[model samples]
Target: KVDQSVVLAGVKMKNPVVVASGTFGFGREYGQFYNLNELGGICCKGLTLHRREGNPSPRIAETPMGILNSVGLQNPGVDAFIAEELPELRTHDLAIIANISGNTPEEYGIMCEKLSAAGVDMIEVNISCPNVKAGGLAYGTKPELAAEVTRMAKAHSTVPVMVKLSPNVTDITEIARAVADAGADALSLINTLRGMRIDVNTHRPILKMNTGGLSGPAVLPVAVRMVWEVANAVDLPILGMGGVAKGADAAQLMLAGASAVAVGTACFADPYAPVKVRDELAALAEMQGISKVSDFTGAVKPW
Candidate 1:
């Protein structure tokens, strides 16, 4: 039998199919479709120190091959999540990863401390949020700022800290190296690429936010390339995510060097995407005469 289990940065996952942040939303709605325990891990919706109202309406726009979102990190706040969501999530057998975004290093540290104490399996730091103290520059766009945030989160959290890297950078590998050196336990890569859609009839932008982060099958190649680059540049385990829709997609990311894969936009199309990917990955592994799915990690052969 093919063993699907994988250990990502010291956090044990039943399988390698994790639901990406923003898409899973604490696994409540999707929980109705299937058993949450059937998957590997769940990276809950992005959380802030305080609850946010998010952006204006028409925040989501459909592109040719993907969707763009400008949700603005709307969440129930960290305190509320710990009080209202953690208890129920703890009952699940899979890993519960808290995805957090903060306006400052201190905010990230504070949330990390609170989430860790609240018993989350790990903290997925979303440095894509604008750093208020840095004059609204995203931490993930700057290597030093990204490292600073990673250090602060690692310092305050008791659980493993996995910094989620943004794809809106010139050199993702440099940012990956920075976080890795700053004590990040693991890394998740290729957070949505910035994009926009326009309506010629109205002569205006399609989304209320004008531009949003693009995610879906359109970004799969970029995700794979970045995952491979980061994996080769740094020695940290990676939770590669972007446009994973099926088992072959997951296998592609794993082969590109992701220790595991996360399904994001695919969930909007199929709530059972994660489970389906997991089963398909196992089947593919068995067919390839591979006994363990983990063997797919970084197994790509380049010419």
Candidate 2:
């Protein structure tokens, strides 16, 4: 059998297919569908300082080739996650990556410190989250703000930090370089691009939040491009994600320069996407005469 195991930022994973945060729901919900241990890692739903009720009705809107959502980082708070979720999640025998978001740098540090103490395999800092201190501007949209959050998380977390980048930025490479320079051990790219939907009849915005993050097949090309750009710009390992719905899509991201690929909206459509992706990736690697899946990373040729 081909070796699918990979070492990302010092953490050994069984494979390079991770379930994106927000889609997996602490691993328990999806565990009912399949064996959670069959995949590389699970990035738990985005966590916050306190419980969030999320936005009002119609938080999600369907687009032609994608969906838009403004879930507002809804979660049961970090304390509860650590108290109740972590113990059960540990039973899965897979790398558990905590994805944390904050309104300020201090909040990010606090969450990272707690997750690190809890012994998570890694911490994925969601810098795409809005910084309340900066008037609701996403931290990842600015290179300086992204670097600041990366510094804070790296300082407080004992585990390796992977700064998740926002595709809404003018120059993603600049942000990637900033975060890498700020001591981020890894990176995850192309968080949902900003988008919206409107009601032609009522002449109003369809979603309550009006603006939402877009994800699905439509963003795959953008994700690959951004992953390639960031990969070329930084030496950090990348957890590339955008619109990965199949094993071929995962392979495309890996070839573009992702050490691993995270399944986001695909899970909503196919609960077994993580396992299927893992299997498909292995099949593709063998078909390509590759024994080690890591060999596919950044294998894209310009010629």
Candidate 3:
């Protein structure tokens, strides 16, 4: 077997395959399908300072090879997560990366402070969730806002902090480097592309929110490119995402410089997406004579 163990920001994951936030639903919906412990770790659903009921109905609308959502960071609040979800999650024997979001830098710090004291392995600071306006675009679309939020989270977070980025920015790599320089231990990208679907008959957006984050196979290529760009911009490790749905897809990201990857929309296509990706990566590593997946990170041949 290849040396697949790659640590991102101090937390050791058996491999790079992880369940992306929002898609895996805090590992609850997938429990009936597979052993949650079998996976590397889960970037749980976005957690806000307070519990959110989520956006209106029709939050998810399927497309040709992608999905759109405006779910709005719904969660049981941090305390509930600690009291109920975290306790059960702890029993599962896997890294628990709490993904937190906030409307302001102060709120983000407070949330990170709460999770840090909980001893979570890592905190994925969600700075870009385009489905909502207040907290979503405020940090993601601006380099300064991104860095401010990232620095604030890192200041209060004892655990390593990961900044989740959006793809809507004009220059993604610039923002990525800014966040990294702001004290982010690592970064994960590219969050869903800013997209919308329209119901021609009704002349309105298909999603109840009218606009949503687009994720799936359609966005994989862009994600791969962003991974390479971000890798070239910063020395810290990176976790890439977008529309990875196969072993080769994961391999491609690795080759492009992803230290690890998080599976989001792809999970909607297959409950065992991460497992299959892991197996696929294992096979690819053996075939390519890669001793460790990290060896392939940023190995993209020049064009």
Which window of 10 residues has the lowest lDDT sum in candidate 1?
A: 128-137
Question: Where does candidate 3 stray beyond 4 Å?
Answer: none
For all predicted structures, in order, the TM-scores are: 0.97, 0.96, 0.97
TM-score of 2: 0.96
Model 1 C-alpha lDDT per residue in residues 151-246, reported as the tens digit of each score: 999999999999999788888999999999999999998888888899999999998878888899999999999999999999999999989998
Give stretches of model 2 more than 4 Å off: 130-137
Highest lDDT against the true fold, candidate: 1
Candidate 2, residues 1-303: lDDT per residue as tens digits? 889998889989989988998888998776786888887898998888888777777888898899898887878999999999999889877889998888789999999999999878999998784312231346887888888999999999999999888888789999899999999999998788888889999998998878888999999999999999999988999999999988899999999999989998988888888788889999999998999999999999999
Question: Which run of 10 residues does model 3 get worst, by summed lDDT?
Answer: 85-94
| lDDT (CA) per prediction | 0.89, 0.88, 0.86
lDDT of 2: 0.88
Query: In lDDT terms, how accurate is model 3?
Result: 0.86
Q: Write the per-residue lDDT of candidate 3 for residues 1-303, one digit (tens) a residue.
A: 798788888889888889999888878767876899777788888898889998998888899989988888878998888777777777786778999888899999999999989868899988789877778878988899999999899889999999988888888888988898899998988888878899999998888988888899999999998898888888988888888888889888888888888888878778898989988888898998888876777888997
